[model samples]
Target: MPGNLIHFRRRVRSVKNIQQITRAMKLVAASKLKRAQDRIIAARPYANRMLSVLNSMARRIDPAQHPLLAQRDRERVMLVVVTGDRGLCGSFNSNIIRSAMNFIEDEAANRTLSLTLVGRRGVEWFKTRPWQVRHEFVNIMTRVDHRYAREIGKGIIDYFSASELDAVYLVYNEFKSVVRQDVILEPLLPIRRLEFEQESDTDPGVDYIYEQPPREMLDFLLPRHVETQIFRAMLESEAAEHGARMTAMDAATRNAKEMIDQLTLTMNRIRQASITTEIIEIVSGADALEG
Candidate 1:
């Protein structure tokens, strides 16, 4: 009984320690979630405005006039898969990876697809696969900035423009809310027409003149647009990862607390049973002695 009590007490202590660790992890995840969410929110306006400007510019330019806007007989495709570097965030990474795999499988026989992975998770996932990896950018999830995105964007644009890759696609998790994230695949090159819902349109009776030329402005804007899109995706993925981690850690903490409570209850029950047994034994001994 003494041995059982000691063992049960140890188990209770172990669970309590795990509960503390889980609580700490939950707090840390909460802090990171706030910062990541703030960053995503702050970047939304800039990304949206950039998209609006690009849409306006793309509407004015003839698709045949711009190489980036020209659709080719794509024999080679480049997939830029974005995921988190770390994997404690529930199914965030798995969702993106699975979507990416599906995408690759869909494009496998149709076109020769090359990979440009943005996170360690994606890189590790594709390393053993029989596909080709053109480029990989690890540790980008730690701190996603415009510079990192621009560098990646520039390389991809250069390759695609040089006809190394005929088409480019990006896959990432889009942050919807704290509890929801959607896997998204967006075409990166060959700027497509912006589709919006039908609505009664009001025309501003004002026309603006271009300084240099529409083609030149598009030449500069298209690459920037791609960079902005990638940056926005990175931000969304980051925020979603943090949100998932926060939720997962919070659940883990709660589960740990519940487990500790159950263990403690069991320990207390065992101790009480031991006490009852000892009392019964003592009473039996006294009765025998009296007899």
Candidate 2:
């Protein structure tokens, strides 16, 4: 009984220590989530308007005039897969990897598939697989920035322009809320003009007066549009990862606390039983002496 009490005390102490770590991690993750969420909120509007304008412009112009508007056979394809660099965030990494694999498998049936892995988790997983990894951006999530996205987006644009890649797609976790994240697969290249018409908030019937030729405007805007898209995706993934970590750590901390409470209760019961036994033994000794 005494040993059990001692063991329970040690267990409770260990759980309390673990709970403290988890609580600290939860707080850190929540702080990061807030910052990431703010960044995403600020970035989305500009990106959306720019994309709307570009798409609107693309529809009015000739496809031959702009490389980005060129629609080609998807015989060769690349997927920019985004994942978290670290783990312990529940199913965040696994869900991304699973979705990517499924997409690769489906695409492999009809065309060539390659991956441009972003984040360490993606790099590690794809490197061990049979798929071809075209590019890698390790630890990019540590600091999500437009410059890093621009570099990556430029490479992708170059490949598409050179006819090395016919199509490019992006796969990532879209942050919807603190408790919900959605896996999103978005087509990046061959800008389908019609898709944007549905998403546009502006009047589709209206036209814009351009200072430069539409072709020249496209030359400048198309590349930057792609970069903006990549940046937005990075921001979304970072925010989602932080949310997942925050939620997971909070649950862990709560579980640890529950465990500590149960252990403490058991220890108290054992201690109470030991005291009762001692009291009974003393009473019997007194009776025997009196008799």
Candidate 1 residue-wise lDDT at 140: 83
Winner by lDDT: 2
Model 2: per-residue Cα lDDT over 36-142, one tens digit each: 99999899999899878777776766778877778898999999999999997989999999999999989999899888999999999988798888889998897
Cα displacement (Å) at residue 104, model 2: 1.4
Q: Name the lDDT of candidate 2.
A: 0.89
TM-score of each: 0.90, 0.90
- Sequence-dependent TM-score of model 2: 0.90
lDDT of 1 by residue, 1-291 (tens): 789889878887887787787678778877887888899999999989987776655555566767787778878999999999988788999999999989988999888999999989888989999999988999989788999999999989888878788899999998889888899998888676654444326633223477968678778878888899999999999989888887887787788788878878888898899899999999999999999
Clash count of each predicted structure: 0, 0
lDDT of 2 at 238: 97
